[model samples]
Every structure is written in C-alpha cells, then in structure tokens.
Target: MTAMHRMTLAELVGGLSAGDFSSSELTRHFLDRIAAHDAQLNSFITVTEEAAMAAARKADEARAAGNAGPLAGIPLAQKDIFNTKGVRTSCGSRMLDNYIAPYDARVIEGFNDAGAVMLGKTNMDEFAMGSSNETSWYGAVKNPWDTERVPGGSSGGSAAAVAARLAPAATGTDTGGSIRQPAALCGITGLKPTYGRVSRWGMIAFASSLDQAGPMAPSAEDCALLLQAMAGFDERDSTCMNEPVDDYSAGLTQPIDGLKIGLPKEYFTEGLDSAVEARVREALKHYESLGAELVEITLPNSHLSAPAYYVVAPAECSSNLSRFDGVRFGHRCDNPKDLEDMYCRSRGEGFGDEVKRRILVGAYALSAGYYDAYYLKAQQIRRLISNDFAEAFKQVDVIMGPTTPTPAFRLGEKADDPISMYLSDIYTIAVNLAGLPGMSVPVGTVDDLPVGLHIVGNYWSEARLLNIAHRLQMDTDWHKQIPEAFA
Candidate 1:
C-alpha cells in the first residue's frame, strides 16, 4: 500500500478488483503523488482533483454493486491536447490558455464511460510542434530519470508523469514521433496505433493526417488495457477506421515464437549513438532468444522521411491552425486597428516561437507557386516511404530499430538548434507518414539513460505489436525500472 504509486495500470485494476484498495483510495494516492512530485517534473498542466474524487466514489459504488467495467476506477492523465468538457483544453500554447472546452474529446468520453478517474491534463509542446517539451508554453517537462534532461516532446508531460509514477498511465497523441520518442526517453511504453485506428474528433489538430492519439504507460500490457478503451471507430471523426478493434489485451500471453523481426539498415546509420545501437542490438538478440527470427531489411526511402515530414506536416498544420484566428474561441488581441491587424496581432501574440516557425514553414509550403515543388514532392516521398514499408512487411512481421539516435539529452542542449531537435524524431516520422502503427518499449539503458527499442507493424497489427512487446517485458526488467528519486 505504501508503494501503491509504483503499480502499473494493470496491477491497479487487479488490486481494485481484489478489494485490496478502493478506487477512491487509489485515486487519492495518485492525486497525492501529483501534488507532491509533479512540481519538479512539471508534467501536469491541470489537476482535476474534485472531478477525479467524484468519479472515484462512483466507481467504488459501481464495483460494490458488481457492475464495474474493465478499466473502472483507474486513475489516468490526459495530454492537454485533448478537449475535456468544462476543463481548460490548452494545447500547451498561449492561444488556448484561456479556452475551456465545451465537450470531451472522443478518447476522454471513452475513458469516462469506462468509469476511469481523470486525474488531470498533462502538458505538451505548443500545438505539438517541437521535438522537446521545451516548446510548451506551460514550461518544459523535466525527465524524471534526470531533471536536467528533457522528456521527449509533444507528449513529454504524459510520458514524464507515467515515468515518474505521478500517474498510473496517460493518453498521448503522436504526430511526428511525439509519443514514442517521449516514452523512449522516459523509459516507458508508448503505442501509436495506426492512423485512423483511433478517433481524432476532439484531439486538437497538429498535422491532421499524422496526429493519432494513443496510450503511454509503464508497460505494454498496461497500454493494451488503455488502448482497448481508447481505440475504435467514431462516425464523428471521418479519419477513424470503421474496422473492428481486436481485444488487445486478449493476446498478451500469446506466443511470439517464429515472429520475424526486421532490422532496417537505414535506422542504424552514422548518426546513431554507439551505446544506443549496442543496446538496440542486444534487444534484437533477446527477441531472437524468444524464438523470433531477425531479418536484415532495407527501407531505402527511410532517409527521405524526415525531409518529407517537415514539409507535409507543416502544410497540414498551417491549414488546421488557421482556425485559431481571433474570430473563433481562442485568444484575441485587444484594441485591434483592423481585421488584418487583429489577425496579425492575435496569431503573432498567441503562438510560441516553435509553433510560429512551423506555421510559417507550412504556409510557405502551401503557397501557390511552391505547392507543387515542395508540398507535392513531399507527398510523393511519403508514398515512397509507405511503399518501402509495404515491401519490408512482405518479408517480415514487424520492423525494429532505435527509437531515437540517443537517449534523453540535457535540457536546452538542442533548444536553439532546430535541426538537431528535428533529427531526434528521424527514426519515428516515417511510421506516421505511412499510416503505420509503431511503439517504443524500454529495452535497456546507455550511459544510465533509457533507450527504447522501436517496433513498427503493418496496418491494424496493434495486437501483434502489443504481444511482442509484452513478451519482451515479461523477460526483462527495463520497463519496470523507475528513477531512484521517484521510486
């Protein structure tokens, strides 16, 4: 009971069902942790203490009546990117800082329906724009492993919260490797379901086509349970897939024997840290021991993924972010000279530096004359990257690689160098462009910093991906290792 904060979401569910702890007690324990430890991590933007306690009470009552749902009473955090009814849904920017969402995002609705307690909204990069959480207007999230280092961006707060044991698990959106990158740096598990596998209705858009919400937790098994509740079709969101979602948790114990693990030659190139590469290679060896075969595969166009992503993501973001112009529900500048001035001032005042940079780049890519040269060319490259994956999948079940070139780097180390920051997501962006499911599992550490083994699967292969990761987790303690300070 004293170490309740250390339990995974799956363990918490078991404890709740076994009557070892009431949902209210569990919720209170997490709320207390957030209150105590989150100040240092700066992971949470808001803590819905009253709503969480109320929900916990209701869950306890339902359990007593023998009508509890699978995730009933589990305390979790939501990334600020998701709209929460009656709560501030800031996208970690000044623009939405004062905006309270009128309704819950579909994922929020799903969790609420399952009677899960909403702990709070975790911080994120402003408009999900940066590779490091430093882009967040609320402030950067410090990696729990080492406060001087960053918890990877965009979904950084969610990863940091779960990694630091401030919350059992949290929701995160992956756009250009946000979820997986952060999870890897924080030594946790993150799953980015295939594009359209999860609804995007109430998720604040970054790059519409690439933004997919998923679960970030301490273990793949914990992610499976949360994904079970988070993923599915939603007519309201045209991007949501209508296909039936497999019971993700049902196959956790399924054997991954004879699984073909593909190693992309492009992912292990010059820039990769030697220590990080060694750990990833060791992870592949472990999978080989589990009866999984390793195949050397080539994603020839993988090298072009970063360049293509830079263009395509910005173009889409420019269009999507245009709605935030002062006329609507976000921030508005006071005493405007005219409509043009208002538009200029509001946007200029609202967006952070990173968001502004992306917006300008996006606007340029979509410009009339440059559209074909830049945006169209990038789209073609995206298709090539997707085709490479298609060919690789023909020979292998899943592609494996290093999630990042290195582990959690010191905060501000690359803040001024945008190129270095963008390169951090190089290994992960292609999966998003190709609309594939990808995950990051803590495999080992390099120089005492966590390294993630990247796993990518074909479309709708989330179940297989989870099974593979869970098998590895069962044989290793990396995912279970918490920062000594947090522990």
Candidate 2:
C-alpha cells in the first residue's frame, strides 16, 4: 500500500494539520487509489473527481486561514442511500437510476459543513434490501481479502472501500446489521448508533424505524471522529433525539477497568460456525485479561429477531417504497394503455427481484385480512425482543457477542436461499429493535477471514462503547491488519 493509503483517518488528520501534504495532494492520492482498484472491487457507483479536487483546494485554503476543523480536508465515501444535491443517489436500484437529489441528506450536509471532501457515492443492496451486495444493480462488491467471497451488505461497498484503503472512512446505514456485519466481514470498524441519535431526514427510507446512519472506518478511533460529525439532533426529523452530542474521540482512551461485559447465551447456540465461535471466545478471554468482568446473560427472544425483522422491516419497506409509484418522479413506463397499466409496468420493470420479493411479502402481511396475524404479531414480538435487551442491560453495562454467525461467505453461496441469507443478521437485528447503540470491533481472524467482537450498549451509550472498543484496539493489532493483496 502507498504511504497515503496506509495512514488511518486519525493519522491523516494529524498529517493534514501538520501540513505534511495539502488537501489537494491527499485527495488526489485517494482518488488515484479508487480509480486504480475500484474497478476490481466495484465499491463505488460514483466518483466526483472534479468536485473532490475543488473541495480539497478549499479545505487547503481554510486550513491556511486557520479555520480548519477536525474533519476538514478528509475525504470519505458516502453510502448512496443519502441524498447529495446534484448527484444521482440511486440507493443501488435502477428505479431511481436517473434521479438527482435536489438537496443533501442531513448527514451529507454535516460532512460538507465540516469541510470533509466527498470522494464519491458507494454502492449498496438495492434499496438496502439484501444481506449480500449481490442485489445491487451495479453488481456485487467483492471482499477485498478474497474477491470470490462477498462483502456483507447492504453497506458492502462502503465496507469494501474502507477495508481496501480506497477511503479512510465512509458513511453506512444499519437496519439489521448492514453496517456491523459488513464491517466484521471486511475487517473494519462500524458503529450503529441509538435510533434517532442521528437525523434520518433526506436519507432514503428502507425500514424507517430500523435504519440509522453511522460510520465505517479502519479503526474505532477513526469511527469516533466520523460519528462525532454525523451524530446530532435535527429539527427536520421529528424522530431525532434532541440530546446533546458526545465527544466520541475525547473518550477513546478511557480505562475500561471494572467495566461489565455481558455475553448472551442465545448468541452462542447451533448454526454458528465453529471457527467464528473460537475467535469470539478468544477475544472474550482477552477482555477478561484487561480487567473487565464477563457475566453470562440471556436474551431469550433472540431467536425470534430474524423472523420478526422480516415481517416488520418489509412491512415498513412496503409502505415507504409505495411513494415510488410511477405517478411521481422515479422510473416510469412508456406508452401505457391506462393509469393502472403504467403503474403495473413501471413498478414491474424498475424494481429488482429482492426488492419485489420484500414488497410482496410486506404487502401480504399488511393486507386487510392478514394484518393481525402477521404485521401486528411481528410488532408484538419486536416488543418482546426489546424487553429482552432491557432486562439484560439491567444487570450489565454492555453486551458482547459474535457480530455474525460466520465470516464472509463466498459470493452466491446463499444467493439462491433467501431464508439462509436473512439469518446473517440474526445477531444484529435485536439491537435495532431495542433502539440501542452497537458496534463491531475487529478482534481476530477465522480461517483467514476477520471476526468482530460485537458490542451493544444501552441507549445513547455511544461514548462508552467507543471507549471500550478503543481500549481493545490498543491491545490488539487485528484492527490494523490489512488485506495482503491490498497491502
């Protein structure tokens, strides 16, 4: 890897501050890397070269004028789910392939306000629907470590780009492990903040209740920096919490002595790969060595998470996506016989298979006669899952587990099996249900694939989680390990 590519986000910030390289030079280095290698990984759908150069020059000028912020001059990729004015925010589907956002998502505005340069829009699952990135119309995002294997999705492209050093950091949204699962599989760090801790305005909705945008980066410290800028209340989103934001980077080095770590019994049962289990256990032992107490806990309703998520998420997705009917500005059919024909043909032609499947399932669950039996029941079950986390947290400060049941699986391995694919987010969905903050920290490798030590904290406990993760990272080099091919 080139010197610029090898530098972590934290190091880059210091380099920029010290005038080691101009922002234009730094942006060019990363843009060059993306141009050289992204064709192989298919990580980005758009690379704003001219815009990036212009922004970098402005950042350089701002720094020279002593008006630089922590993130100024930093270049990061954005998940296409967020709207960027004048840029096509496709959300990895052809339905909005030509749609140019007229305004920026709150997250995009935050980054721009911090003077961070936008590298490009990264790819994702179509409308953020699939567990693997294969559902993206741009094609699958290959895991940088093993190109034949899949990078976990729907934030696969963001994870891959960061993992391969294409960008120091990127934005990602997690609705049932899109951020953490991909970060775990890609050997990077990803944080899913408490629901409403970050604004959802202008972010393309998949499951409104479950989707929350956060950061993906090479290390917890880097994520801390990114999340600092991304997390805050916005009046534009009614669901956003009106709480004060924490200085995540400030607490990264805090001691974890006397910290309580809960290990949920339900997360360690059958179907978990043996290698992944071993690595997770090893990390738990390491935590014990660091003077943290580990207490066995129970989230008994964990098994119900995947099933409940499928019901509730799709139900919300069906409703949120209904606005995309051809009558408005998305993809539309030509030469329609009538309004009904236009609506039918336009939707049928625009949506991908996964998107269609979820929409149908959702519509069925929310249908008149079946509403109580499916959608209502799933919401009740969601309450049970949330209750389970509440009970567990009553006795522990944070919960720890394997982020996913396995390491990155090969591309197409579970493509034909939708049920199997859904199980990939089993360990992660409960956190979203509970509206709590969770993160993935690289702990070790399983059969050459990375494994993450999943950490879930109570609501609004992002600072504590970041500190815990940062402490662990200081003692291990797993987070610093780079893919050999990229290195």
lDDT of the candidates, in the order given? 0.94, 0.93
TM-score of each: 0.99, 0.99
Could you give candidate 1's per-residue lDDT for residues 1-487 as a string of tens digits? 6478878788889999999999999999999989989989999999999999999999999999999988899999999999999999999999999999999999999998888999999999999998889998899999999999999988999999999899999999998999999999999999999999999999999899999999999999999999999989999999898988999999998988899999998888899999999999999999989899999999999889999999999899999999999897989999999999999999999999988988899999998899999999999999999999999999999999999999999999999999889999999999999999999999999878899999999999999999999999999999988898889
The alpha-carbon deviation from the true structure for residue 299 of candidate 1, after best TM-score superposition, in angstroms, is 0.5
Per-model root-mean-square deviation over C-alphas: 0.8, 1.0
Q: What's the C-alpha lDDT at position 330 in model 1? A: 89
Error of model 1, residue 252, in angstroms: 1.0
lDDT of 2 at 93: 90
Task: Give, for candidate 1, the lowest lDDT window spanning 10 residues.
Answer: 1-10
**Clash pairs, model 1 backbone:** none
